[model samples]
Each structure stands twice: as C-alpha cells, then as structure tokens.
Target: MLEEKGIKPAVVAGLSLGEYSAFVKANVLSFKEAVQLVKKRGQYMTDAVPLGKGAMSAIMGLDRQTIKDACEEASILGVVSPANYNMPGQIAIAGIKEAVEKAGEILLEKGAKRVVPLQVSGPFHTQLLEPASIQLKEAITAISVHEPTLPVVSNTIAEVFKDKEQIKDMMVKQVMSPVYWEDSVRTMIDLGVDTFIEVGPGKTLSSFIKKIDKTVTILNVENEKTLEKTMKKLAELEA
Candidate 1:
C-alpha cells in the first residue's frame, strides 16, 4: 500500500520476529525462503527448551539498568535476563521458570509497579535459546541472501546492517539476544524519522514507539478501515 501511494520510509526496522518482515521488505529474502526458514526457526526454538521448563514475564515501572540488575541477581538461581527493552518502563525478562519467578519477586521488591507473567511457549532471547540460534544458523546457511535495498536496523546491536555477509550471523544471534527496541527507535529518530507506520496485526509496536517519542507521528494499518484512516492522515500530513 505504501508503494501504491508512493510513500517511502527513511529507514526500516522490526522487533524480534518482525525482523523477518523487514528483511522481506528490504528484498534480502524472498517470501518462500522466509517462510521455510521461519518454520524451521520456530521448530528449533520450540525444541530448544522443553515445555514448562522456561517462562517469560513483563516488568513494568522499572528502568533498564534496574531490571538488568534484577536479572543478574536472579541469575544465581538459574538462567534469567532482560529479554526485551520494549520501552522506558516496560521490559520483558525470560529464562528458566524458577528463575523467572524469582526475578519477578525481586523486581516487585525493588519497587516495580507490576510484574506480569507472559503466556509464551518458552524463554526467548536468552542464553537458553542458544541451541535454537545454532540450528537457525545452519538452516539459513543454505539459503541465499541479498543486500537490503533499505537499511534494516538490527535488534541485537541497534545498528544498521551494512554487510550482507553478516546478515545471517546477525539473524542467528538475534534469536538469543535481547531486543534493543528502544535503542533501535532512538536510532531511527536520530536519522530523522518523524513518522512511524507499523504494518502488522496489532498496535503494540505503535504504543512502544509512542512511549519512546510521543512527538512523532504513529499509525498502524491492520484492516481496510485502518488503512483508509492512515492514508487520510498521511495525506493531511503531506498537505
């Protein structure tokens, strides 16, 4: 739709699984290859950790460093770490079930306003997913990748991917690395991205972007109504 309307983004980025969409949009991976790769990737991740062994939770009303420290403190019990820095006060932690539970308690004790456990299949973006990362590396090695037409910011380093040869490695590592969402958004803002249009099913990303920079224009298109609304809004902006 953006193409039909002659709308071009200054930069492109995605969060976690959303990165694959960015890759497809950037022409780095074909639709077929992306589907095959994502299927195997999902399997590898599901097999990496047994059901009921791993868990994830959202930590609200806490700073990044404090959450990191809480995870580090909880690590003594088992694997636990900050998984997603979603926004200023919203972060996700993932690891062994026991450790995650412990971390949740610690976070609340440290003055966190709330700690809610997430309903996820397993602990993602933690060292426990390293096995999945390894498998993903092997799966992607057989596929061909091209340099992105537009820069795709990585969740691992919060940097633009410049080397085509490194894309595979970045994707693999991304499976086990915390998503630097806030940092990635800040990087785009630094590059002068004043408008963000999330092309997905939910408004979760838009909410996060708003928290990061409320002054920026944010829009999401999930259906025809939203699409029309967003197009009208963009026309107004352009006018």
Candidate 2:
C-alpha cells in the first residue's frame, strides 16, 4: 500500500516483536517466513520460563543509572536487569518475579515516582531468556536471509543491519538483550529520517518518537481512517 502511493522509507526499524516487520520492510525476510518463524519463536520464549515465575515492571521518573543500580542491588535474590530503555524517564525491568519486585522497592526508595507491573507472558529481553535465544538461533539457521536493500535498525545494538551474516546472531542476542529504543531513534534521526510512519496499530512508537525528538513528524496507519490520513499527510510533506 505504501509502495502504491510512491512512498519508500530510507530506513526501517521496530521494537521487540515489531523487529520482524522491519526485516520484512528491508527485504531481509519474507512476510510468510517471518510469520511462520514467529510461531515457533513464541513457543521457545514460553518454554524458556514457567508461567508466574517471571515478571516485568515499568519504573517511571528515574534515570537509567539509578534503575541499573537498583536492579544490581536486587540481583542477589535472582536475575534482574533493565529490559527496555523505552525513553528517558520510562524503562522496563524484567527477571524473576521476586527480584523484579525487590528492584521496584529499591527504586521507589531512591525517588522513582512509581513502578507499574506489565502484563506480559515472560521475562523477555533478559538473561532469563537465554534458553529461548539458543533455541531461536537453531530455528533461524535453516532459513536463508539476504542483505537488506535499505538499512534496518536493530534493537540489541541501536544500529543498522550492516552485516547480513550477523543477522541471525543479532536475532539470537535480541531475545535476551535490552532494546535500545532511545538510541535507535537517535540513530535514525542522525541518518536524516525526519518523518516516521508507523504502518501498524497503536501509537506507542509514535509517542516514544515524539518524546525522543519533538521536531520529527510521526504518523500511524492502522485502520482505514488512519491510512487515509497518513496518505494525505505524506502527500503534503512531499509537496
């Protein structure tokens, strides 16, 4: 649909599960293959840890170092680490349920505004997901990937997919690594991507981009209404 309207992105990226969409957009993977692989990937992640044993929480109004220190202090109980560096003040931490709770308490004492638990299946993007990442590596080994026509930013390393050979390795690492969303956005802005069009549902990424850099134009295409609005906005920008 975007192609039919003569709009082509200079670079592409997405957050966590959305990274698969970025691979498809950059021609690194086909849509069909990504869909099929994701099913097995989901199973691997689920199998990595038992339900109710893991937890994630969002700590608001705290800097990264403070949160890191809190997580470190709480790690003696169990594995705990910062998962997603979403924006400046909002960061998600994940690990064993008890450890996450412990870290939340520490952060609270250290002046964090609030700690909100997230409703997710497992403690993703943490060392706890290493088993899942190993299984994911083997799963992607059979599939063939190609060099992307355009740059595709990665979550693990807030940088473009420069090496096709390392794509699988990066995917393996991505499963158990923090998503550098803030750095990734800065990388895109450095690459001269001033306008961001989120082609799928939700305004989450759009909101994140706005917080990162209010100077950029952000749009989303979910339902027909949003699609038409995005198209008209793109036309105006091109003019």
Alpha-carbon lDDT, every model: 0.92, 0.92
lDDT of 2 by residue, 1-239 (tens): 77777878999999999999989888888998898888888999999999999999999999999999999999998999999999889999999999999999999999999999999999999999999999998989878788888899998899888777777889888989999999999999999999999888789989888899999999988888988899999889989
Poorest stretch of ten by lDDT in candidate 1: 1-10
Candidate topping lDDT:
1
**Ten contiguous residues minimizing lDDT sum, candidate 2:** 160-169
Q: Report the CA-based lDDT of candidate 2 relative to the real structure.
A: 0.92
Q: How close to the true structure is residue 146 of candidate 2, measured as C-alpha lDDT?
A: 81
Candidate 1 accuracy as TM-score = 0.98
After superposition, which runs of candidate 2 have C-alpha atoms over 4 Å from their true positions?
A: none
Error of 1 at 216 (Å): 0.3
Q: How accurate locally is residue 228 in candidate 1, as Cα lDDT from 0 to 100?
A: 91
| Candidate 1 local lDDT, 71-154, one digit each (tens) | 899898899999999999999999999999999999999999999999999999999999999999889889999999998998
